[model samples]
Target: MNTRGQFLSSRLVNDSLISLFVVSTFPPFRISFQLRMWDWFQQYCPWVLQGISMVYGMIVRIRRKAYQREWLRPKHLSRPVVSVGNITVGGTGKTPFVIWLAHQLHAKGQRVAILSRGYGRQDPSKNLMVSDGKGHVKEWRVSGDEPTMIAQHCPWALVAVGPDRFRLGQWVLEQTPCDCFILDDGYQHLSLYRDLDLLLFDATDVKGLCGVLPAGRLREPLDSAKGAAAFIFTRSETLSSIQPVQTCIEKVIGQSINPIVLKMVPKQVRHLVTGEVQPLTFFSQRSLLVVSGIGNPRSFCDILTGCGLEVGEEIRFPDHCAYGQDEANLILEKIGQSDQDIVVTTEKDAVKLREWFSKDDPVWFVTTDLEFLAGEEHILGLLDRAGVV
Candidate 1:
């Protein structure tokens, strides 16, 4: 599909309430008449588009069946591979969770390696490894927003990207004696058998989604949650009322898997220019302009409002949106027309913005992390039992 076509199609598939169940979050884009569209689409054309998408989806399922039938056995590397991913598409805070897991493993003296697909990379290569900045050059493109963020944030661990993570895992094991290989966003990549699977679900958007692919956001049905070793409800804040939310999720999945609920809250806001970290409290006293182009922009806007920031205006864009010069100019022009003073964006957008846009250009980026709540220890215990640490 062309870029605009891709965006529109993606928006339709992702905008449904069921999309929330699959991905960890919702589509950040908001249509002008979203409610009316939802009412109409849900009432009429849901089956038509969903049926079309399911044709593409069924092809994928058959491909998965090929693997299951032993036609595509993934090679087993020397070390155990633990995959951190979600069944649905979009952000599940996989980067942050990987970072957190690596640190936890590192504290126990276990070496870890990460493998990714490196989506949106400029270079074209099937087998590639990220560089370690030493005299030695590692093979792949360190270009995707999430991979770059992972590389920079976790320098101690080795990071690589390839379409075939099973191959990448084998290569990394040959290069380094890593104890564990962490597969980033490889839940559906069935060639490799993972030691543990963490499926992240966004709490806010699950209400409207009721069915399977194309008709809703689910890459697979909600029943796929049963396949995961553990389910992580990411970005669930106090405002989300996670307990009842967790109960609802368990009910939907049908097995009552007793998955752990992890709550992630924005604890601090950073000045992109000075690199100063300030308490999140400062947002309460400010009139803010929230800017984000991610899978779930409404959640970020809700976060700001939840934190007591007077969210004057919110700008949303398609997921993985590459802000161009024209778009930047338009944003600056809009800002000039508005009386709202401060600007804030999520950390994921901040990385993309840094490439072309900057905080010095009168934009302030607010970076947040997935902070696990009391259930953090319970999860750690599970990992411990699994010998992950």
Candidate 2:
């Protein structure tokens, strides 16, 4: 089907399904008669809206040889390249894992650098570097949420953003005598050869995706998991039977690859307005207004409620969405009217808020990271094989 038809089809499906659920809950609404029209729309509009994206992928795949001919042939920099990426769209926990991995490598006295595309960055024209004015300062955009967070935490490490990963990698090698490189969110970037591919999978979306794009959320097929030296499962906190789930995923990974189970548990809940770090127990008595502009809002809300927070409201926005002053003011206004309600947000949104919102605003940013519990050995062993450690 054409692009227009495909989009209409997807919209029809979404609208019809939503209408059905809403009508079921509100039988007195009298919108049940419109169900026939919805069904008709769904039938006539049955097509795929992702046709262009799928076609683009196909063209790239077809021309893989042409692109590979002049791929970034970087001279072996001192440090090995460990890429953290996923086959699907979002919510893979790449940033936290990279931070965790960097901290681990830094502890071993190895100089590390991070390269990323800096998704959702407003300016994509030039190469930018983010650092804390130390030896690792390189040209990469510091404006990105992830890069800024990395720079803030790992001030000593170099982080750069560029469309051309190979050029950026070479530039890093020239500027800093780094021992290793960590590719952030670079699962499908095949132009620059990576020594190790680390793929992350969100357990919720793993069940029903085709191999190509447009049909499902995946950038590639489920078999794409095989490319990674290791597979890390994000949102592991949701799994009731964690051990059995890990076993099943490990079986899919086979003998050659290792399975890493990482969970993003609530370590602490900070008061958004006061910046005071409190134990998660503080959430039990709080009337929370949970706000997050992250890849997975459901997960964020779940974590808050799971920690015993009475989630009275949840405001979710697009991933890396830049909030205007007025939008934040509205939230502030709502909070002001509440009875000492705690306004909660994620670290990513926190960065944007700090940059955009007034300093005196009561909104608080709570940070969370992926915690690799049992499979640290497996991940470390893979890095060892790559000679990164």
Candidate 3:
């Protein structure tokens, strides 16, 4: 094929795969033949994935090399920029982690500003105010759920959303200058230079080779994290579970480094509107219908089960689903007919549901907190070195 022919053909394939991925994300239609074909490719046609991954890896390397070679100059500001990101595409509890980091920084008397691409917002391409110094979000849909959640949680910190961080940073500086900036989900955002890069990873088995794309969750190869100043492992149930992953990381980076282990601890289960709080075990006896539009629904289910909730049914939508009236009606119908007494969901989903459900709704969201499994001082030390304090 000619150059243009190959380019068009490749573009067509990329478009097709993206469409398939979209279809596969939703549970209702995910089990269709399209997904089945994808599964078949993964199981039997390994070389095809390998071929695609090689091309993908080349693209990743070339783009990174462009930035490294100064063919593309990364924007750098006077203020310290701390980035929290992951190699994988899906959420590794990054939003909650960002909020936690903000809380810690604010406790130390630093003016913090959070900048996100505002993924899944109605108009995320343009810069907008998620929080105006005080925790006040203009519109949940306008700013995206994660930024909105941060704004709701951290009243003192400022959160802004724009796809272009360079433009967003300038706009933020003009509006209100901050002492420090936290770039959320910014590992691949090479347009900006970060003083500190904290790469986050979900706990996985070390024995398995870190795979990419259709084969695995790795957005970039394991070698990519070698440049990170520190590695943070999230969702470790036990101290022992972290060792193997740590060993793997050390092996990849060619040195022994102490990585921070974080636990996503359930904080509380609060009513969607009534302002009533309950212990996680409050729903121990009450059969619950769990609903979530999150990246990791299984983890949410596991947390609920761990809390001793008698979870009966689960309805999962794609990550950052803007719950419409039809979805609301379905939830209501499920709540009415199911043996469950009430509905439970994640905070991200709760933000969307508030638009559909009223204050009297039986829906409750489980608020989670990220706590250090061992090295709380490491996070403090990183901040201390970054001049966050």
Candidate 4:
């Protein structure tokens, strides 16, 4: 080949390599690129995603019918099981709601056991105990971030982790006494029969209910939610925000279902290393280098902003991200030795980030609780109806 042609080829290869490095090394770039590609596909080849979603919807309906027809009988444990789940993929605040439910059960002197699929765990196939109703028995890496966070919040609740929640619940019953079981994210787990199914939806996500799977965020068609004992909308601060999603849900159910609305209120901010909790007001007006690796990062940021903290810089990572020293270094670089600037994250991320950050670092995490804005009595009424209380 000619010298000019060789030079041009080398330049093209180098440019491609540089572009790949930027996309892989930076989270923002990678996420933006992925979104752009998905948008292009949706705009040009809409049939492909729609066709896949149609097939997925059919499979969902068939599986649901199997359970209904007793072709696939659901196994029930001796104890009552209450499931907290969502129709959409993620970010429904299941962990916080689970924690809240556990606390309520604990108040009634009922021994509670939390059964989880332990998504994002290193060895999800193996059944593991996260907390034995006293404290954590395994690390976050083994138990998964959401389960670990639940265990941390509800130390008095026994937490079991595995793919098969029925088997996990059985094993827990054998090892220890439990008055009831809280199935974490078990909406689609038809293998186990639940006494009460609490289906959750993010009120802010109006567009999420558009379709199923590849075409949209929904895991199953809207009709699947009809089986839920009661529907709960999370992050519902205003009526206007909740109306659109609620209307869509009622339209599909062919009835006026007055859904329960829950506002995720920030409870406290605790130092990761010292374990000292500061009031949410302590961070008011302070500059924050916000770091989050959760399903609804925008919700987290909005909560921080609502607390009157200034988000000077923000870094978003994929949901259930396993933090490392390199990521910590990158965060520290963003902070850049500013006394007024501090790093803030969600409690879920804190579980994994603690390994890379220490007491000396200006790192803290926010803890949130579910506050019922509407239909608080509905939850209690459902619990009573299910005979779980």
Candidate 5:
């Protein structure tokens, strides 16, 4: 119609296009900036973080006390639930340990079902059955990466995901025959009563055990660890490496407790597309373009280096990162720049990246296993005593 009207419409369209471009392109930079700012705040503004942590700690204490005093009652399923969790916000090799435990119970002829909150999943369903004792029923995005990986490893075990694990367990029991349940990341989940709670700690991160929430990595006070039936020190390089953490925990719990020590060793490398298994020695001394979106990228890299692989470049994304075409393109660019290096990632990341990368891509994932350095018999005996087996 009018010239002014046309001018205004063109301007509006241009502005909208520019806004969309910025919104789409700014996320990676925004996430990086936010993480840096958070780290800076944690370091330089201790008083502020300490104040927030104090408030958070009070809430945690109140909720725990309510559960203990029966102000809030925990619901239990017909089958016993064995919880595998860590106090810290990051990884302590829980997936591998859960897979190991599931295999152990499965070998004993127990029908195991894994219950998880399915953190970072996009699905809004109340309860999603990830696997039905045979294979995955839902994709990784719907079931979350960790649960998908667990289901992939433990095909015979049923995996269910939902916020309310008690309801999820009930749903599983109603549908299938499950002898017991394995609660993943259930240390803070107080609504469901667990027959055995195994608390995990990263032995390498002893300093992270100092405070709660914003002040440190701990989800609750060190004293809360006493509620666990047993403690497990994961990524244990040696007894000396774990002694500091054990001492700190024992002092807070006001007693000495036996801790199971586990070393997460790389067992094999598997091709993500072809399902071809390769030994660790297959890639020894070769250059790798390491890509990971996990809580413990340093640990994963260390395992790679320990196996004699040179990390040519590393692309670290935030934990449980939902990979898309942008990430796939970035990874390909990095790989292209590297000098004949193979691409490597963690199993958790591989679950999502498999859809992004092709079958012909030189992408491999490291599969790790829990090697119990100590207290193996103690854990097995605890499982037996709890009637899990």
Candidate 6:
């Protein structure tokens, strides 16, 4: 009516406030509102993280009492090593339980190698190998994403990487005819020597064991798993939901241990460019689309929406993400304009999107394992007391 109808109603209220600030900055609404503000600072800042987890649990009990009195010893390697790790950082599946403990010591014939301080390697200080147990000759950014997804699922098992894992376990036990050595994420790698440390966790991480790095999500503390001898509980489902987490780990390491539980599942959906093996009812109710970079993308979208599928959309990244090809053509143009139909991910993001997908790309990858709901033969008697049977 007046000055050009008041400049067309102030440009329609500044274009609806710039479309609600770009739909609240998209990308899964800014990664689920920055993970609900880091889960309300790890659950209402436990009494303000008890004075920074008591000066970060007193430097993790003085670097674990300087590797227990020896003022730092740990460094042997003439075989026997076994160490699958985790105390709480994320993804406590520890590379699918170190490819199910390297297929239970490569199905009895023994001889498995793993080692890995590789986490997202590029030139992680050079020491490579990535696989010599038969495949993946190197490159998941130089063997990193969980040691290239455990050397593409234990090709016989021998995945290596460096940053000094006790000199990369004396250079993959002098390069091969190896007899043991698993170690990926070796329980805080206190310089090496490990005839079994096996401490993994994540039946929902017990409130991220209350504080260490940046204030929670412990990297140490929980007495660094008190020199772990048992405790394996990954995303459990049964065995009486692990009896109040085995009475809260026997009142936090005051003894009473023996707890295993496992139950992971989703054992393989494959095909990231023709390895095939698809049918898990072709992902049940379809319309899927779940991407990852892992470190618990909500337990990989609640274990693929509890296997029935129907994810709709999710694309998290920041946790070892490397998928190049301009991030696979922006994740194939956001799953080709939505309404999904396919695109699952996580054999650690399908080993970094197999050189960025191509051969008729429909892309898939499920592969999870760990099933021993109630001490399955007590994890083969702790891998026969770590001597690898």
Per-candidate TM-scores read: 0.81, 0.78, 0.88, 0.88, 0.90, 0.33
Residue by residue across 1-389, what tens digits does model 3's lDDT show? 11111111111322123322432133444445666777678779978887888778778877877987899999987788999998875557889889889998888889999999987899866899789986567677888888888888888888999988877888898999799999999998999988898988877434223666656556777777876877888888877778888887788868887778888889899988775899887887798888877766667777787777776777666677777776777778767766876999998888888778787888999988887887779878988987767
What is candidate 6's lDDT per residue for 1-389, written digit by digit as tens? 11100111111322111211211122445644655654576578656645776787798779888988888898888888888888767677877778877887889888788878787677888788878887756777777788877777677778888888888778777766788888888788887888878887777556666556556666777766778877888888887766665666577778888888887888768888787887667778777777676677667667777777777766555577665665576667766767775888877777778877876878788876677877868878888976777
lDDT of each: 0.65, 0.65, 0.77, 0.81, 0.82, 0.72
**Cα displacement (Å) at residue 20, model 3:** 12
For residues 1-389, what per-residue lDDT tens digits would candidate 1 score against the true structure?
A: 11211122123434545333222112323332454565577688777767766785677667666766778876666677788887655455677788888788878888778888887666636656574423233422235666767766677778777778887787776776788878888778787887777777776656423545556566765655666777787767653455664666577667675546656666788775566787878767777766676666667766777777787765555566555555455456657768766778888767666545564666667766666654677767777777777
Candidate with better TM-score, 4 vs 6: 4
Q: Judged by lDDT relative to the true structure, which candidate is superior, 1 or 2?
A: 1
Tens digit of per-residue lDDT, candidate 4, span 1-389: 21111111111322111221212134455555665666677789979889999999999989998998999999999999999999886588888889989998898789999999988899989988899977746798889998988888888889999888899899998899989999999999999999999999999887789888787778999988888988898998875678999999999988888788899899899998888889988877687777777776667877888778777666666677777776777677657745446889888988899878778998999988788888888898888788888
Residues 85-200, candidate 2: write the lDDT tens digits. Answer: 98766566788888899999999888888888776577865677767338454322235778877777788888888888878888777776788899998777777678888987
lDDT of 1: 0.65
- Between 2 and 6, whose lDDT is larger? 6
What ranges in model 6 sit over 4 Å off? 1-47, 50-52, 68-77, 80-112, 115-154, 158-182, 187-288, 296-312, 315-338, 349-389
> Hey, what RMSD does candidate 5 come out at?
8.8
Return the lDDT, model 2, position 213.
42
Least accurate 10 contiguous residues by lDDT in model 1: 1-10
The CA lDDT at 310 in model 5 is: 79
Which wins on lDDT, candidate 3 or candidate 4? 4
Q: Which stretches of candidate 4 lie over 4 Å from their true place?
A: 1-37, 337-340
Model 2 quality (TM-score) = 0.78
Clash pairs (backbone) in predicted model 6: none
Give candidates' CA RMSD values in order. 5.7, 8.0, 7.4, 7.3, 8.8, 19.9
- Best model per lDDT: 5
Best-to-worst ranking by lDDT: 5, 4, 3, 6, 1, 2
Q: Is candidate 1 or candidate 4 better by TM-score?
A: 4
